[model samples]
Target: FALIHSRWTRRVTLLKRALSEIGIDPRRVHLEWISANEGAKFQRTVSWYVNEIKRLGPSPVAEVVDGQA
Candidate 1:
């Protein structure tokens, strides 16, 4: 996890490299913005990410998939 400001700027490239490095082929990607001062934003962000991961169904990585489920 990362702070929103530093996170968004590198999100795309970071995810790309991350997936590539881990040998995971991502069918899709998502980016979200939430500032440090925004409690509501942080809550929403976590909720959205949780929902998104659920929608994605499951991951090929067993550990990660099990963690989410």
Candidate 2:
């Protein structure tokens, strides 16, 4: 997902610990950097995550653990 693509890379060293506090799966999120001028690259990035989520159906990371809020 595009949820953390921006900040994850900037703070990857601390992402997992941060995610643990919020019940999110870092693996299910993707962080990529595409140059602003690289429209094609951006499109491909979007498509990739879209297909990934499609295959994953819905994310269970947040709701499967004893009714996460």
Candidate 3:
């Protein structure tokens, strides 16, 4: 479990770096660990992330892909 957690942490860090390099907000990425019994926690996490994404507004990468950038 420790090894898996370490690997995921490293992967997430790398992902954030790649996103930043591509001009995307690193805050747009999220990583959470919730057990199967934590349904409420999962719901709350999803809700919070949704609100955060809304607060961040549309991604700049989307505009570039749509040829607007």
Candidate 4:
């Protein structure tokens, strides 16, 4: 578990950095370690993330696409 977590942590760190460099908000991205057995947890996490993103209004990328940025 530790090895898996460590590798995932490194991957997420790199991903966040890359997103930031591209002008994306890193907070909009999320990484969660959910086993197949954690169906409820996975559902909850997805639901929460979706709500959070909705509350953020819209992505800056979308604004640029709509010519509002």
Top lDDT model:
3
Ranking by TM-score: 3, 4, 2, 1
lDDT of each: 0.70, 0.72, 0.95, 0.90
Query: Please, what are the lDDT tens digits per residue for candidate 2 over residues 1-69?
Result: 366764566687477567766765555667677888999999999999888878866666546655873
TM-score per model over all chains: 0.51, 0.56, 0.92, 0.73
Q: lDDT rank, highest first? A: 3, 4, 2, 1
Q: Cα lDDT for residue 45, model 4? A: 100
Model 3 misplaced regions, further than 4 Å: none
lDDT agreement of model 1 with the native: 0.70
Candidate 1 per-residue C-alpha lDDT over 1-69 given as tens digits, one digit per residue, 9 for 90 to 100:
457566675777688678867866553465656567999988887788788778877566875768852
Predicted structure 4, TM vs. truth: 0.73
The deviation in Å at residue 66 for candidate 2 is 12
In candidate 4, which residue pairs clash?
A: none
Off by over 4 Å in 1: 1-8, 17-33, 63-69
What is the alpha-carbon RMSD of candidate 3 to the true structure? 0.9
Question: Model 2 scores what on Cα lDDT?
Answer: 0.72
Residue-level lDDT of model 4, residues 1-69, one tens digit each, is: 899899999999999899899988888888888999999999999999999899877798988899997
